[model samples]
Every structure is written in structure tokens, then in C-alpha cells.
Target: MTRRYCSLPRQSVPAFTPGLAAERLGALIGGRRMWVNGTVLHYCFLEADTDASVIPVPGTGETRRVPWAGAREQLDVVRECFREWQDLGIGVTFAEVSDRCEAELRIGFQLGDGSWSEVGRDALSVGAGERTMNLGWDLTEPGGRWTALHEIGHALGMRHEHQSPFAGVHWDDEAVYADLAGPPNHWSRDRTDASVLRKLDPAEANGSVWDPQSVMQFPFGPGLILEPEQYHNGLYPPGSLSPADKEFVLRWYPPADVPAPLVPFRSAPLGLGPGEQADFTVAPLETRVYRVGTFGESDCVVVVFEERGGEPRYLAGHDDGGTPHNTGLRVRLVKGRRYFVRVRLHSTWGSGETAVMCW
Candidate 1:
């Protein structure tokens, strides 16, 4: 039987789930790395020399430093993907940087390394001067666009749609293991389990209905999923961002600029629904440690950014982060310095129940 190499894009979840994701945690420019709406994140490409050519071996606790093997002819594909995502009109902005030391995303293209990316805020934790993303194959191929989009989605905090708890996919484990063990993938049983067979924690799932065409899904050929019988033949996404993908991101990262008017010491109501955010600008009168906190019963994350040269610089972060406690953080403020507090709610008990205050 002729194997399909196209299905073997070899795309993995970069470290927040596996590794580049983990890489992001240390590489963060500022001490904090929360995805506050309207924040600007920069990405840089790895060139020859230093750790630019290093690839961390996933699950083996090892790494390899070798010459870059990327298909330079299609070099601009990643940037193109970022542009397409920006065209979606989300609040967060993406920029390219020449220095890896100053970038939130350090990408590499070592041949045979397989395509993967850092997931979300973890990009901040990536070791300084290390690569947090990689692409092994040429992005000019048929599935290349989707691969880039999918990996970027991960970097932006989107998890695998197939791993969604709402997705009722029951896999025929043996068939999946056999298929992935062959050409292009050669994944071991453990690797296959971690990538395809494993299910995500329900808490991590974004709680949306499974959109089969989500670009953040793995292309499982026919006869892999035994349950959800509709997918028994195969579950191949259309190789593009789905409507849900755009909607999900848009809800979390709105297009309109969030103002900083809800001043310090004044409790302001967060007039947002699920997946909505509020930005509060604070102008400190004196240098001191201050506390910002959310009141009443609500689930949210709070990120603080200092305005530096017209850009928001990360300062600190705190969150309910899936626990019962409301989010709060204590950050030092410099006299006359302007700062912004971004609060995003995952869910709230009632319309007027959630509010935040800084003092």
C-alpha cells in the first residue's frame, strides 16, 4: 500500500503542550507573558550561529545544533501567515524583529525537525536566544499554508480542536498507531499517544462545539476514528481557518482599542461577556507598590503593561486561572509613569457581577 506523505506534515504542538511552547515561557521579553488584548508581540527568525540552529529533541531531554535546512525559496510564508491572521482584525498585533534576543517568537527551519510552534504566553518562558518555533518542510507545499496557520494558532493560545472535550472522536488506536508509525512520521507508540491518541483536559478545552474543519486539527485519514461514526472514513480539515477559528480569536482579542479610562482607585464594571476583555490605563502619581484586583464572583485573568515609547511593555500578571479565587496582582509603579491593566473574563456569574479596581 502506497503511503500518503502529504498527511505527514509532522506538525506537533510546540511547547506549551510539548516543547517550543515550553521554550516561549523563558524567551518572554518581560517578566510576564499574558496575551492581553491589544498587546504587540514580535517574532524573529533564527539565522546561522549561536543557538539559532539548535533543535530541542522532544521528550528525549536532548538537543541538536546543526546548519539550517529550511527551503529559503518559500521563506516569507510564515510572515504571510501572520499577515493573514492580522487581517482578521484581532486586537493583538504581530511584528517581525531582526534580533532574536528581543523577539517573543524565535523560529527555526531545520530540515527533518518537523513543524511545531510555541503555544501562547509560554513563548515568554523560552530560554533567551533560543528558538521557540520551527518548520521542517517547505511551506510552498499543498498543506503548507494550513501548517503555518495551525502552528501560529497554537502560538496564540489555541489548542488542538481534536483534543477538545466536545469532540466525540473515539479512535481505533491500533490503526492510528500503525499508520503514524510508517513513512514520514515514524512516530513511536508513546509519541503517537501523546500527539493523536491522548485527550485534552476538559478545563483546557475552549468549550466550543467541535468544528471538523478547524485548521488546528490533525489530518487523520480514513478509518481512524471508530466513534462519531460520521468520521469513520476520515477526518480531514479543509486546510484553512474555519469560521469558529476566527470567531473564537475575535471574541478574545477584539478589534476596537480598549481605553485606559477606568482610573486607579475607582472600581469599574467590566461590561464584557464571555471571552471579552477590558483595558484600564493607570497613571501613577508616586513610585510605590500597588494592588489591582477584581471583585465579586468572576473568572478572569489580569495583565499589566507599562506604556513605553508608545508600546505596551509587560510588567506583571495574575489570574483566576481556573481556580475559585478572583484575579489580582501587586506591581510596583513608578512616579508619573503610565500603565495599562488588561482584564479578560473567561466566564461570569451575572451581567453586572464582575468589576476591577486598582489602588
Candidate 2:
């Protein structure tokens, strides 16, 4: 039997009403970004010597101490995965950081905790010093490598492909629970249900065709899939990212071609559709505090990055999720330094062309 495992990309937010859930999941659908103002995200792992499981085992205080050897292997795989995704030229970029204070994606490798990551920007809501991603199983093996890819997809705001509304997969819930309880997974019934069995709302599925081979898909075993009869025997996603995954990411975060320039104290029309973002290069005249904000009643995510040696570094970000007020970020800007502001519109209410200004 294959040593199968699963990636549980759980939401940081607890259960809520369906309407609110979709509303929240909507932002993630567009990609759970750290304000995706096209900032370069930095990921770091907990020190193998100091960090322990953030979630205590429900009963026993027994926690895992990630082995440095395996953690080292996991780190190499993650770096490769980061470059793989980066090579695609998608809206995302990543860099490894040593300090947790400077990292947005804080990864932990506590064995027995099971593999998982909080979806997208939800990482921000996590406690300042908590693990946002985990790799419980050894990742040196070929099969285990996929877990890193899948969890990173989650961190980028991708949902489970098997749960896609268009997937048309009918799961044998009992069989799923029983199978996951053994060997590689060892997930409890609740974990299985939460990560695998639950179907997503169509709105959250991005209205795309189901791609069984997507890296975001879990490996389904025989007797686990009972629908779409052709796959009834089993469903196995290609261990690597699929073509569909690439296309979807590219479409959502299409290249800016050339970013627009936004002058200080001058407003620029976003003229962006919902789920769309605009990028601008902002060069300040003096070294001082600068404020960037979007006007009009809208839901937006605003992020500012400092251009350093051709790489953009995340500096500040803010999100207004379907709120009455606009979103803004204030930061100290230095003269002779190049900066950029990325603003994504979630939705505009009672208005047309949301505009942003830096002052």
C-alpha cells in the first residue's frame, strides 16, 4: 500500500454563517494573499531547538520536536517549490528570511501534528508568533514532497481541488475516515472530514472546471471515490503542479506589463474590476511619513513594498473587507528610494472607479 498523507489547509477563522463564510472565502478564492499587493512574501521555519507544537494535542501534552535532519530536507524542498512557483512569473514572489519578525509565512515542522497551513492572508490573523504552516511527516521521500507543494498552494489561497464544485467527485465518507486513520495520515475522523470530505461553495471554487491532477488535490485511494464512476477505482493527482494550476494562477495574477506611476498627493483611478488589482511605482520627494489610501466605499487590500536590488520587500499592508470605510497604510518613506503600492479591489459598493492616493 502507498504511504498516503494529506494536507489540511484549515482557516484561522472558526465556523461562521454561510453568507459570511462565502464572503470571507471569496477573498481567498481570489487568492488568500497577504494583501497580494504583489509583495514578495518571506517564509521562515521555527528553530528546531526552540519551537514546539502551537496546537497542543487535545489530550496528551505530548508534542513533537522536529528532527533537524528532516527539517533540513524539508527546507530544501520548500526552497525549490518556491522557485518553481516563482519561475511561473505569477503575481507572487518568495524569499527566505532568518528572523521570524520579518517573515510573513512562519513554517513549523512538529511531527505528529499533521501537515497543514492557514489559507492565504489568514496568516496575518494568526498570533504574532504562531506557526502558519507545518510539515509533520518526513518530506525527504518522493511521495512526501507533494505535501510541501500542496500546503504552499493553500498559503497562496488555493482551495482543495477535490472539493471543487465542478470536480463531481462523490466520496465514501466512512471509507475516507477509516483509511485516513491508518499509516501515513493517521488523521482523526474530524480532521479527515474537515480537510477532505467537506465540499466548498461554488463561489469559492472560482467557477473553473475540476482538475483532478492539480497539486491542490488530495490523493484518493481505491474505494474512497464512489462517483464519476470512471474514477471510482481511485483518484491520484500528479505529485507535481498541473497545467490547470499554472493557468489559474497566471490568470488571476497576470503580469502588470508596466506598472503605472502614482505621484505623491495625486490620486489615480483604479478602474479595476472586482478581484482585480493595480500596481504603481511611487517615488517620494522627501524622507518622511507617507500615507496611501483608496477612496470610495469598497473592500480593498493595500500593500506597499520597498524595491531593494530588484527584489521587492513587504513593508506595510491593510485590508478592508466589505466595509464602509476605505483602506489605507501609513509608513515612513525615504527620499531617493523607490517604492510601490499594490491595491486590489474586492468589491466597490455604491460607486464606480475607486481611486488611490499617496500623500
Candidate 3:
């Protein structure tokens, strides 16, 4: 059976024995929080003094940064991808064409040796010199679009397909470790375990059909797994998103037929002071959970109120009793209603950073 593995280009090869190479790869790939097998994502918190709470553009006052010389053209590709996904019934909005961070999703490519991105709401935690998404290659390269879509997939909360609990692949562990440790991949045993062998929880399958051709899948040659015939040496190339991929995305982010009742908040770390209040209108959804959280020592409280006939009625309130040490609350919301989320710092602790979102 043939097995496919992630190999480094010959020109980038390092001087090291197979065992040593394997150890290094394992450390680099497995030792951090990741969106996929090899993609590393970091946690960045909003600064204590920032007025806005949603992930802000790295610099102050709407100024933005670009990754490279052709960043403008590259952004077109990203915007088009968002449009494609939206056309397929996904709920996503891309900013108007420009060379800056005027949208919810901002990615700046800096000098780097690899690609990485934060998953979903984690993008809010991005820091300076760090991006929600980062790329080492230029958009003109052969795998540029594939790389963008792949990282964006992570941004959308998708994980590696190989790790799906439903994917019934059997790895030839010995061969996989040997190949990755020897050349381009030079992955350590633990790295190999996390990337190629670890399985996601069964609940993550989301009832969709399993697809080996997913863009999230990594190429593995023969002998890496027990059933070579069943698993193609290179199951799927990194070109277009597979049919299952489309279905999966749509399922998670279906089309929104109604305009949002209020403008979605984009500022990071909505720093609420004592008794401070913020109002947000919840748009229609079949069902949704709203999460409110804090970053510092301030004890935060949340109260959900629904406006009926122009009068406010309290629905629920969360105090320090909730899990995660009383710094957050999870509230379920109904459709097509204007709900106000009042957030404030509890007594004793005067002020701190807070965040609110729904999914």
C-alpha cells in the first residue's frame, strides 16, 4: 500500500538525522493549540484600555495592514471566496473592496515560514505582529488559493478531516513516523500522533456525510495506512472545496434571510465599567446561544431583556453562580426579536474587559 505524507521541499531541508528531525517536527506541530494537524493558532487578549471589544484592526482608528506586494489582488480572491460561500447559503459578509481592515475578518501576512490562523471567535484574541490568519507564500503561488481556503476553513471552525471520528482510516504508524521524520516533514512521534492519528470527538461529525475528498484532508502515500486501495495515495488535492465541504459549511452557517436588527458589534473587549450597559438586537435564527465573557478580575453579570410593544421585559440574568468562575454567561435567544444584553461589572471590582457573541 502506498502512503502519502507531508514532505518539505528539498531546498528547505535541514541538516539532521531522521530521529532528531522527527523530534523537532513533533515539538513544532503538536506543542501548540491548532486549527488542524499542522496549522498553529494562538491566543491574544484585548488590551485593558482598548474601548472596542471585538477583534479590532491591529492599529488604532480603522487603519489596516497588508501582507505583501500583491495583497490587493489576494484580497479579491478572499472576497470572492466569501461570496461563493454566501451564494451557497452560508451566512457571511465580506467588506467592500479595499486594501485595509474594514471587515470582520482581517488577515495580514508577514514574514513567516509557515501558515496558521485562529479558529472562529478565537480571531478576537489576535495581537500585534500576529494575525487572525497568516501565510508564508504569496497569492501568485500554485497553492495560494488552496492555502487561503484552507486557513479560512479553520477560521470557520472546521478541523482536519483526517481527525474526524467518522473517517475510518487505519494508519501504518511505523511507516508514517519514519517518512515524516526522515525528510521534508521530519515530524516527531507526538506530532505524528496529534496530526495523523488523533481522532476528534464523535459529536463533531454534525450528521453530514463523510467525505475523503474534503479540502481539509491531507495527502498520505501508500503504506501509511492499512487499506491502500480504499484510501487514495493523494485522496484530494488542495484546489476546490468538495461537495461535502460545501454542505458542511452551509449546515453550520446557513443563509440569513432577514437583515440584522442592529449592526453587529465589531469592537474587541467591550470594556464595561460599573453599571455600564450595552444594547444589541438579535436577528432571526432557528435557535442560538449567546455567550458573554470577561477577561480580567472584574466580576461580570448579564441580563437578557426583550422589548415588547416598546416596553422592556427582563427574561434572564446571570450572576457569579455560572460556571467558568462567574466571568461569563450563556443565554439562549429567540428569533426576530430585539433583545438587549446588559453587561456590567459586579460590585467591588470596578472595571474590566468583556466580550459578547452568538452562535
lDDT of each: 0.73, 0.76, 0.50
Where does candidate 2 stray beyond 4 Å? 7-9, 13-37, 54-71, 308-310
Evaluated at residue 250, the lDDT of candidate 3 is: 68
Overlapping backbone residue pairs in candidate 2 total 2
Model 3 TM: 0.53
Q: Give the range of the ten consecutive residues with the poorest summed lDDT in model 1.
A: 22-31
If scored against the real structure, what TM-score would every candidate get?
0.79, 0.86, 0.53
lDDT, candidate 2, 234-283, per-residue tens:
88777898998888777766665468899999999988777788889999
The prediction achieving the highest TM-score against the true structure is 2
Residue 158, candidate 1: Cα error in Å is: 1.5
The global Cα lDDT (0 to 1) of model 1 is 0.73
The TM-score, computed over Cα atoms with residue i paired to residue i, of candidate 1 is 0.79
Report the lDDT of model 2 for residue 137. Answer: 73
TM-score of structure candidate 2: 0.86
Ordered from best to worst TM-score, the candidate numbers read 2, 1, 3
**Model 3 misplacement above 4 A:** 1-73, 96-104, 110-112, 182-186, 206-208, 257-359
